[model samples]
Target: MATLSEIETWLHDRLPALLAEYEVPGAAVGVSFGGEVIDHAAGVLSKATGVEATADSVFQIGSITKVWTTTLVMQLVDEGKVELDAPLRDYLTEFVLADDAAAAEITVRQLLSHTSGFEGDIFNETGKGDDAVEKYLATLAEVTQLFPPGEMFSYNNAAFTVLGRLIEVLRDKPFDACLREYLFTPLGLKHAATDPYEAILHRAAVGHIRPTPEAEPVPAPVWALNRSMAAAGAMLAMQPRDLLAFAQLHLDSGKAADGTQVLSAASVEAMQEPQVKVPALGLMGDSWGLGWELFDWAGTKVIGHDGGTIGQGAFLRVVPEHGLAVTLLTNGGDLIDLYRTVVGHVVKELAGLELPALPTPPAAPVQVEVDRFLGTYSCEVADVTIRQDEDGKVWLDQTPKGIFAELGAKPEPVELVGRDEQSLIALKPENGFHSPHVFLGDDGTGRALYIHSGRAMRRAPA
Candidate 1:
């Protein structure tokens, strides 16, 4: 295992590489191991002012807030105030869906596991009243279901919004307040508030967006979603060390820094158990827990989650077996792959184990007949024309530039890393896609049909 000093040096050296490569403003990292935290910060917090990053600089954690929501729900379960499998409508009368029957069958557990089959990003609150949650729930009569309940994992943000509403109803308080009282305060997370924008204005790191390859950066607006959406992505600014404290609590069997048992051991374990299968997300061997993702990293089990805001990214990974937790908070749009890389490197060095690399697609042959795969495959989302290049190498012609970059070069006998009937995986480097690309096609031409947002694509004709 790497020494603490060595790990710190590696972080200092590698973070600049990521910043230079991605052009992000700055990043803060915190790692907890053996009951202590090693916190580090580097680069500029605001590129405009050249303000150096610090460990206390609060960063928006985006969807990493889901863990707090899940923890609150599990706490309610511990108190017998809520049942995981009980229909959510039982607690919130306003809960309903476009499909009345399916909505009635949706359970609390399904929302946390993202298996309610609710459409992702279906609820639009633009121009709505301040009470967006109430307005949206009232409009559920018009909302539609993407799939049936428990059918598969769909990563529905709306479902989590409903979960936040459920929390408000059961607690008789705003969802944010419930999170603060039951989760944040009890855990001694003083620097980890849901609304750090107002709480720590001077020290808060404002999100910035770089519009073009060569353009001035602009401050991104802070999102003001209704508390109903809190479960999906509401929590705000947090210092890296503060986040490490939260991780340590979980590592210490849900005991807070002051040694108070904020959450029962059973509840923590329940949050780590895989409740649903998410094969579509390259997680065939993994499962979605209450609020965490459970997967095998090397031979060790990893329970963690990733988060993204409109212009920021955050990731929290915890290895229970090794009592190690890593948190990365960045104020930029495309830092997820960097977060994963940092985590993998730190874990490898600290635990003396190598993490698994992402699967690579098979290589294309230098020479081969290209007529069998020649066709203009069209899908509902994209049109892909597979043609033979001048070098006789088959390539996916007419592919969107964004999608093509994600797919990389064409390959023969493309391996399916992930698939469903509607989509297929082509080739994705271990780092993952810069922008989401959807795969649309069959196994004959290629499992992937087209490249849409969040999926991979490849050329099949040559």
Candidate 2:
């Protein structure tokens, strides 16, 4: 491992040039190692404003807020106010989904670990009122089950939003207030913002997005998503330093900097214990804990999570064995690559670790039958179709819908290459990396049930 001075020096020398090389609008990076924290920033916050980014500039942490939401829920466990494995309906009686039986059986742990099995990508705008999360719960009544409760692993945004509602009921406050009271104040985080209303007070970095895949990124039309899904990571912005402070709390096992016991030590240990093994998706963890993504780097247990929203991306990686954690927040431009470079550099330098190898198209491949995967899979954001052309080349056609369309998402096609009997890798990179689409389960008919690209997109009935 490198000395903190050596790593800090390397960051000061390389961050600016790397931003230019990657065409990123701006970025903030922070590291917590050996009980100390250090951070650096570079580039313009917005090309439209031409404001330079500072180390204290706040950027949206996106879905990384899940870890925060998880913390709030775990606090309830510490107080004996909630049971982890108890059915969610016991707490929120109004909780109902398309499958009443599955809804009745869903437990608090299922939502925490994302094994509740219902469709999770539904990001309904339930209004900006305090009832947003409560109303959002009502919206899930129509959401279909992707699988039975506790059946398998799926990345679930709705699950956390539902958990957010649970927090509101348990704490007698709105989700934002719970965050501010339970986390921000407890940890003494000064730079953290829960919503756009508060984010405006800081030197906040706006997200950037490319209207078309071929163009340079521009300031996104909006700064954050609707507040209804805030608990599911719609709006939470903070400087890299404040973010590291939160990570430090976990390293100290729920103890804050002032030696305050904000979270219980048992809950902290439970959150890092593996709960479910995810599909063999290279982009995420091999398995998920209560809220954290558990990464197996060679044989070491690395805990972390990644978040993306409105062209902004945030990454948090923690090597608990070395008492280390690192985070990178970026507005736009090849974020996956930048994260790989920046956090990858941090992990390698501070912990003597390397990022896991992601799958890519094989150089030489034998074509296989594609008829089994030839169908349309539907989700809230997009409708993806798997089809083969007359030339016998299989490709995925993705057409944006709902919220994705509102953000100007476009339809595009990417060739698919055989990875194995049950999985395929995109022949071309979209955004910054290729998606390894894994097909699994039975849809009651003899076809592929779900096509998982991070989130499980269930196939529409034939």
Candidate 3:
């Protein structure tokens, strides 16, 4: 095995190349092995000031916070304070779904596993504070089911808020306090907390977004959660090393380095057990366990989660069989794309192991009469021009910049995948120029609409 010093030097040398290629401003990374932390640092903390990142800089860790919340709930389960299978309404009387009977069927286990069918996110349109959370829970009566409870997988944030509410009811304390008492304090995670109201001016990494090609990267406003939505993604301001400590605790079966039991071994195992099948995301196979993702990398079961906020991206990966963990926290929007590469490189360097290569998407087939797919198409979001190349492959020329040629010679129809209700396909090509084109109408003469982040557009005259 490579020495920790060797691994750190390798990362320090390669990480700068990645940041420049991906346009990320700064990152904090930590690695743990054999129940000990081997590496920690802040890299390129600020782009504008050239300030160096340090080991203690705090970054928003988006959905990775879900793991902590779920672990806390499982502790309650182990203590018999809460039953995983029992319907949530048993503890939270305020829990009312659009369908009262359906809402009554949702369980704590279902909520953590994301099978509750509750709508994904309900950011307190009413603003932050205890009243907002209370009002949102009161309005659950209007939240309808997307699928029957536990019958399918749907990543529902509202369900997690309900779990947070349950914690409040059982402990007679706010969710943040409960987390501190049960999880953070037990593990000695001093910098981790869910309370966004606390002053965090210093030791925090500013969130940044790479909005356009020409524009300088912009810092996103510091996002604070209204007390109501804290459970969903509100936990903030953690050093990458602190996050790694949490991962090590879990990898060690919830035992702190001092031998204190932070969580039961069984609870940690349960959190990594796959409860639902996830459709593929690129080279990554999908499966959801408790609040973590379970996937195989080179036949070793690697479990972890990725988090995204306004201007931050964070990732945690653990290989239990090898007793290794890698965590990366970045103050940029593009951190999502860096997870696989960073973790894979660390694993190879430290353990001399290679991750399984992403399966090759099938090649596009031979084409004939590609003209019907050509010409400009427009939708409510943006315009896309489909043109046939000399090689007979179809290319989508998208507006605002970038081009996405069809993947393979034979273009596969875009299909809906997973419970998250996102559309994807094997071999789909996307780039700066290509917009996420949705084929509308029959006969292939329909407009293409950008799904989430494009301005509205109308079809130009033929």
Highest TM-score, which number? 2
lDDT of each: 0.66, 0.89, 0.65
Q: Give the least accurate 10-residue stretch of model 3, judged by summed lDDT.
A: 401-410
Tens digit per residue, CA lDDT, model 2, 1-462: 798888889899999998888889999989988878889999989999999998999999988889999999999999998999999999999998999999999999999999999988887988989999998888888889988899888889999999999999999999999999989998999999988889889999989998888889999998888888899899899999899999889999899999999998899999999999988878799999998999999998899899888978899988889899999999999888888888888889888899888788778754655777889999877889999899988889998887888888885688898988888888888766878999987776668888987788899876
**Candidate 3 global lDDT:** 0.65
Cand. 1 TM to true fold: 0.79
RMSD per candidate (Å) reads 6.5, 1.1, 7.8
What stretches of model 1 exceed 4 Å from their correct place? 126-132, 196-202, 213-218, 221-228, 280-285, 359-361, 365-462
C-alpha lDDT (0 to 100) for residue 33 of candidate 3:
80
In the predicted model 2, the residue pairs found to clash are: none
Error of 1 at 299 (Å): 2.3
Per-residue lDDT over 4-33 for candidate 1, one digit per residue giving the tens place of the 0 to 100 score: 778888887788777767666888899888
Candidate number with the higher TM-score (2 or 3): 2
Candidate 2 Cα errors over 4 Å, as ranges:
none
Better of 1 and 2 by TM-score: 2
TM-score of each: 0.79, 0.98, 0.78
Worst 10 residues of 1 by lDDT: 411-420
